[model samples]
Target chain A: MADTVATPKAHGHVEHHDVDYLHDGSLLSWLTTVDHKKLGVMYLWSVLFMFFLGGVFALLVRLELFAPGKQFMDAETYNKVFTLHGAIMVFLFIIPSIPAALGNFVLPIMLGAKDVAFPRLNLASFWIYVVGALIAVTAMVTGGVDTGWTFYTPYSTTTDGSVALMTFAAFVLGFSSILTGVNFIATVHKLRAPGMGWFRMPLFIWGMYSTAIIQVLATPVLAITLLLLIMERTFGVGVFDPKLGGDPVLFQHFFWFYSHPAVYIMILPGMAIISEVVPTMSQKTFFGYKATAFSSVAIAIVSFVVWGHHMFTSGQSQLAGAIFSFLTFLVGIPSAIKVFNWITTMYKGSISLQAPMLYALMFLILFGIGGLTGLFLGAMSVDIHLHDTYFVVAHFHYVMMGSTAIAFLAGLHYWWPKMFGRMYNESAARVSAVLVFIGFNTTFLPQFLLGSRGMPRRYYNYLPEFQFLHQVSTVGSWILGLGFVIMAGYLFASLRKKMDAPANPWHGRSLEWQIPSPPITHNFHEVPVVTTEPYDYYRPFEPSVKGHH
Target chain B: MWLFLATEILMFGGLFVGYGLMQSVYPEAWIAGHHHLDRIMGAINTVFLLCSSFTMVMAVHYASTNNKGKTIMNLLLTLGFAGGFLVIKYFEYAHKFHDGLLPGRFFSYHGGGPAEQAMFFGFYFCMTGLHGIHVLIGMILISWITLRTMKGEFSSAYYTPVDLVGLYWHLVDLIWIYLFPLLYLVN
Candidate 1:
């Protein structure tokens, strides 16, 4: 059956049908937009700005670690800086990066629908994110939180510097995450094109669907956890406080229960981006589509049980620790399945080393180190040694930054032309990609050794022997920073150019590529009926709508 | 709507788990704390919520059957029951405040059981307070749907708002079913 989604009525004044979402409205129109693409653009810019802020805090943390013993800031200031970095990066940037910014723009267009099932809710989620982010930044600027992002109890309860406000900020952000999850679940279930069955959809949608499940399910626990934390601090609620006859370790249990799954919330979307990029770059159908697709769901399920692995050294029971360790290992299987499928898919196909592909390839290498190192830490005996060391620090950055951030860049580059209708200088982007991969590894690889050598994290000073590795990591951070600068320069420069991209860049087979570059406000004028799978490269490409090549 | 409710369950589920854990840790305090909470008031509030949930279901049924008058009437009844529940809740809170049966450092009752009772009171206020807030929000939503029903905005074919609000009202009632036994009656 043919599907026809009525083009969204014009915002106010009637205009020609040819106007794209970008030009369809004034600046005022954007603030009041219910259009999914416009809201996505707004989210994109907001998250990008947060990325810049988080990156600056990361650099400051690195800069202070350059020589150790107060290179620029003292212990108190350093603690606040690092806490802000983790809080900003995790809450303000990474969680929303793919799902809110990119997913908002692409999910509906890919589903071949007019908009998300709840466009008004989508807009509300974006504004709530903004309000939450502003509150967090305000907390940062005014005295800042030193409890770190975890906000573990007792310490979080006693700490003096706006911890309540920051936790409140996180609580509000959790609501935004939950709303987006609700919107996406409804959209995916109810809004798919008439012919787009569950398995027939793109793997990226699978990854997103899995991530949304965790977001809806896990994030609420975080919301309650944070709210309880605020109460514990403000009202002496005595739930998580040890002095008040409460268990501090219970805070860890509560925090990690949501947080472990939250790491999946961060990584799954990144993996979703890789699933799209690897197949497209290979110019072949995904090698193990069903395996790859199912693995996303599998990972989401396993993530919930593995929160205990994070608390192995926090005085949890031996049996609980053992079970958590075993469950933690379970995460590796699905992750490896995905890694193997991406490799196999690219094994014999014609591969293009474009900027997006380069980032995808980098994700494979970085995530490999990131995912494997997790097993070492998952083993109770080993984690006992490396509990709070730089090793744990290095491991997460590999996953969060090296893998997720790199894949986000890959997706941004891959869809850049489509989103904005202008192509960046490919050679420049390639050079930046190389620098990023090199810089990212250089920054974190040494920390693995520092952590193994017992250089504890969150320390203001360190032994002289650890100094060399710390400096090395610091220099690596500069290289990473420079790579990102060059990327920003070229990407914004592309915006100056006119719309020069065709409907399908990279000859992608996804429904998103079937539409015009800088897709119209309503996406497809008429819904594209899907008959072939999203990555069916072996079959001749079918133009689902008229006026295509 | 079910997906949204799943989030709500998880949110409240965290609190329930925390309460159970803290209860195990301070059983005497939890047991003593229950003595202070008036069971009759708790039972009455529970009945109010149960009746409100029934009215909410009837409202949805009427909306689907195109009985606009009955839908509006049932919704108003649900709102009244919900408001009654909160009014009873206010009296319970005010009595606790008068006796200085507050959470944490504010526990100042002239007759005491255990110091850990402070933590019990903390969880008591938190759990019931959160539930009370949900009750308040439910009233507002019922009012919104009630107004819309009066405006002839819903009928047999389109009563999604009425239906979703009914689901929400049921969840609120369901949580109270758990809270009543755990807080007011459990030994």
Candidate 2:
């Protein structure tokens, strides 16, 4: 009778203390915490650390190439430098930057749920990521891999360095990615709050949902491809060795199968963050929300078929090349639609130049350039000229660095208060955003020109004629690096001092905005019953009785 | 579990894609390569895996219904079939190793065009070796499930583990079914 009794406290207040909730004490509480919010913050910090690490590598590469002729390192070291830059940036940083951190943190909260469907599996995914990263860093310290991240055959199989270690590391990392994908899929399917229909979900969730599908479907191919590479190195399996009559080109097919859609994996979450931030800051609903959501799925599917474009110069069939080229062009349409939708959302709206909005606008302009140049690369004739040149490097950076990195910054500024229960310096953040935009263009735009002028990429040194552009690009990288440091310093400083951030600081219309700052362990005190669409700016909630600046 | 099995399919799918492309380019070499593989051993392994699948399904069924004795009995039969499959695979590999039909540059088969022959065996070794690893892992999982079932841990209401293990067993069987025609009965 005592256990079954439901009674108020002696003072007439509800006894909320004995719920056996989170806030339980111990180091293991964090180490073994299945709370999605905790895991999300963990992902955020870890990915940010990796981003800085990868940025350090990028700066090292730029310093070495600043005016060519081995400014700081020899060719062998340059190869290792760029290889490390690519491996860390792609595998460790960009892919997980927004999705693993922001998506994991906010998705369940947005849906008004307590945690992801599979919480222990979420912990496993994070640990697996940590282990994979350790293995990669270990390989880096021991002379490093030289075959580049693509790990094309023959070279990958025959490389004398730590290819086995690197490939196995990537192989292990793929499982981590797959597990995260699995968790997201299961959570999205089973864990929406009452009354949140498919259409009413925020566009960010739709973006993550589409990205999860790609992560689940395409990551397995990379897992298998890396395994084969491991087999080739460890057991002398001749699957990709040309000398043994094995077709090295087949390895390219397998690698690109996962690697191409992998680009979408890197960018879609960033695009999703932009979709969320742009409309909220602009004081308008997202224009064509359904079209934007569908485009995420559309890009995922179409990206898969266009992987063959990577192998156009690798001796694939003419028919295969033409089909892939055509598909590559077609895939750009969804990306274009997303850009147009974001711009339309901002057209004549109360467009504020906040830090998050600054980053979002930058994402649109840079991703537009990145996506359009991708069409040129998708064209057979143009690609033949720019296949392995700095042009390709410039094209991807616009997408990966310019677009994804900018979106990552936008999301960071957008959700910083929610995650940390504090507000950062808005003016400083906005200044960094502008600096990053200018520095990013100055760094990459020259590479595009150099690439068009016949400057091949992946080489340690280049022709003397390209020295001026390389120097300018290297200088811009320092400015970009300085911008990142200033931004990081501002964020870190904000955390040390307590600054009050309200529950709905942005005055945005999303489910996550309804929750407490830094959220209680069980997210919502009561499950919010959704009745309207996510971005209903026209219908504002009652003005706050007690507002704080 | 289905998703893990799907990953395995794609793993083998990569090899199959390679094999298909190579066979199209060099049909004669592929035919000669096929002649070198021991069809009898391949056929025996195929039958062994198929029987293992049947026994695994039976084990799952019994475990689901809480028939502990029947579940253990069926699992032992499945494990036995897996053992037989591995033994056949070992002998087949031993024969190839003894004939100097190794992979890559270590290959020393006296047959003409040793490079092409090496390519054939390269795929053969990678596919079968990877599959063998899967079989080994499946046996461990099956054994764990068998022990758990003996403790009456599964029932109709809580038989997801049994069902997942059964799905895994069927996938291993399906892979062998594809492997038999491609490796042993190649046209």
* Candidate 1 DockQ, CA atoms: 0.86
Q: In model 2, which regions exceed 4 Å deviation?
A: A1-24, A542-549, B111-114
User: For residue B90, what is the lDDT in candidate 2?
Assistant: 87
Candidate 2 lDDT, tens digit per residue, B1-187?
4556666787688778877887786778778888888888888888889888998888888877878889899999999999999998888889899988877566788977535766677778877887899899989998998888878788888988888988988998898898889988888
lDDT of each: 0.89, 0.83
The candidate maximizing lDDT is: 1
Q: lDDT per residue, candidate 1, B51-128, as tens digits? A: 989989998999999999999999999999988988889999999999999998888887968888888888899899
lDDT of 2 by residue, A23-129 (tens): 44465778788888888888888998988888988898888887658676888888887888899889988888777889889999888789998899989988999
Per model, how much of the real contact set is kept? 0.87, 0.50
* Interface RMS deviation of candidate 2: 2.0
Candidate 1 runs further than 4 Å off:
A1-17
For all candidates listed, what's the TM-score of chain B alone? 0.98, 0.95
Model 1 DockQ class: high
